[model samples]
Target chain A: MIWRLAFATMLVLAAADKRSGYQDASPETRAMQDDDASNPGFLWVQQGETLWAERTGNAGRSCADCHASIRGVAARYPVFDARLGRPITLAQRIQQCRVERQGAGPLAPDSDALLGLTAYVGLQSRGMPIQVSIDGPARPFYEAGKALFETRQGQFNLSCAQCHDGLAGQRLAGSVIPQGHPNGYPEYRLEWQGMGSLERRIRNCMIGVRAEPFAADSPELADLELYLGWRANGLDVETPAVRP
Target chain B: MMRRRFLVLTGSGLIVPLAPMHPARATPVQVAALIAELVGDATLRDERVKLDLPVMVENGNSVGMTVSVDAALGDVRSIDVFAEGNPLPHVLRVRFGPRAGAPRIATRIRLATSQTVTAVAKLADGSCWRDRVDLLVTLAACID
Candidate 1:
């Protein structure tokens, strides 16, 4: 019993140690992510650049037509959309633009075009601190996301906090557990051999714990994303990050 | 009884080394044969080729990697990368055009476990340069 108490105290102290995903990455991975020329995720970012300039749908307008520049735009995403009357992620906003503004068909989740555009937009905000607001109207969703982050589920009876928050920096099945931060969505994953969104990654975690994942664009995922954004409050975004 | 137990322990020790160290996977000899088949009888030197990979990978599914050869090593023809521990060792093969200025390629690859990743470069002068880095993959990829 005394040993159990000491282990619990150790976990609590470990949670206080703040480290970014980059710090947890191997040296080679960090080098690859740090350089644009050597980073594979840039391939998707390049594709996104092309799509940003090309005219699409009946609107004959591109993403560049209105936004002009995407600099620092992604850092403020998963924001409360006044028009939608709810919090929406960057991926949802991209879909919204396609359906409502562009007149183009909605791109499927995890599709190349969607990932490319998201990576490109996210790349623009590289190194900017995440600044998501969970105040006023966004407060309730934030609360729900916090509840989900702490709630236990799955066959393993594990919560996100169990590993990411409590056991972060420790080895699990040989890999170090990192604090579950969403600063690098639309990031390139070596395992996937492609770029993926934060939602896809979250679903992957759910599956890892033997839990049924929420569908793409589910409120649960969005709220969880919002909570993660809040968790990573001041961490600089590293979009298109190359992860193992 | 003590003598009988001692004899049994000695016999077991003798049998252990003969047993396969890694079962259910290709052996190092097999992986070397595959590399030989790819590179042929070319003289593989250790210079010029550079392989960059994480020393420790948290997830085997998406480990970042970069392989490059010194441009000073004359005209380069192609580069082949291999992950000896993966289910399929051959990760990628990149060929450069005649006008290709620098022979540099960057990408991500999946690893089955902790193992050495090798890169072999074929140059225009009919020579092959090789380099390898051993890395730890915490999580296995290609598994559901």
Candidate 2:
């Protein structure tokens, strides 16, 4: 009976820790939210809306001509892509669209086109909770990512858990370190001069850990992104989110 | 003070063999002067710019950042990015049109080493806004 009570207490503490800050790891979203009057995602969405209609490459096929409206498309991303036998991020899917449908070359991993399209698609699911499925094939990818997150890397000898999981909401230097959530992506990073992809952002963190950055389309990044998406399961997609 | 490496361009199209330098020397002043030359007629304020950077970074290859100003985007016409001790001081320049909604940007960058990062914003009225952040880099990330 005493052991059971101790276990229950530990579980409660863990739950409270997660509730307090780990859920929203990125900088506060409110600062970037310009109200309903000015949606930052609006700009990227307009660009994507245009691209969806415009034909490209030799085939001259536009993504919009076939799929048509993809209003809720964003919330379903980082899905278990059957062919790859792993979870695929929205950026990966967008690249596939260009390569398979349009027969065009893959955009540079974090290229502006990829970021723009990812932002565009992500906005379609704005205000909807990110609902990546972790049940089937996605389970393996999530597991792989979780392992990677806990693994320490580079000369810093720090794991992703150190800052995001362990010390989240605490000040590192002067900035309030966020929990490292993946909900807001295809974000318009102020320093980037334009839109940015989750891949690039993930790569940024890799560098922070002093780990060598994987190639833009590397399997590792895909797995890591899947894991992060699953972790942020119920959070709404806030693509083109502003960060500071 | 920041550390700087003298960059030698190699045949492989890569920068090689980083040679360290003193930040308090003439290098940063020259960089500042060069920036001043690039942006003419704008005032440099000690207050208006707010630069966010880490206090201690293990690597210089990727440094997180945030920059903002209290002024409206319409009132501002230009912005520039500078790393006082990096190999190249002029990182980027942004010119805004009337439709440019905001004057804030947050992104990641490469700092050769620990140093002060500054952003100078020039308004349409010929006034200057400047912000500086002291970043502590424990391990320089850009070893290559």
Summarize candidate 1's per-residue lDDT along A101-199 as a digit string, tens digits: 989999989898999999999989999988989988999999999889877777556677766766566655445667768888888766566788888
Candidate 2 chain B lowest-lDDT run of ten: B9-18
Each candidate's TM vs. the true structure? 0.75, 0.60
lDDT of 2 by residue, B1-144 (tens): 123334443443222334455444325786789768856766567887787776765445445677777788888777788887776777667776777667877765777666777788887788887887887754321222
lDDT of 2: 0.66
List residue ranges in candidate 2 displaced over 4 A: A1-29, A35-43, A191-193, B1-144
Best by TM-score: 1
Clashing pairs in 1: A174-B138, A190-B61, A190-B62, A191-B61, A191-B62, A244-B62, A244-B63
For candidate 1, the lDDT comes to 0.77
How far does residue B131 in candidate 2 sit from its true spot (Å)? 17
Q: Kindly report, for each predicted structure in the order presented, the TM-score of its chain A compared with the true chain A.
A: 0.93, 0.84
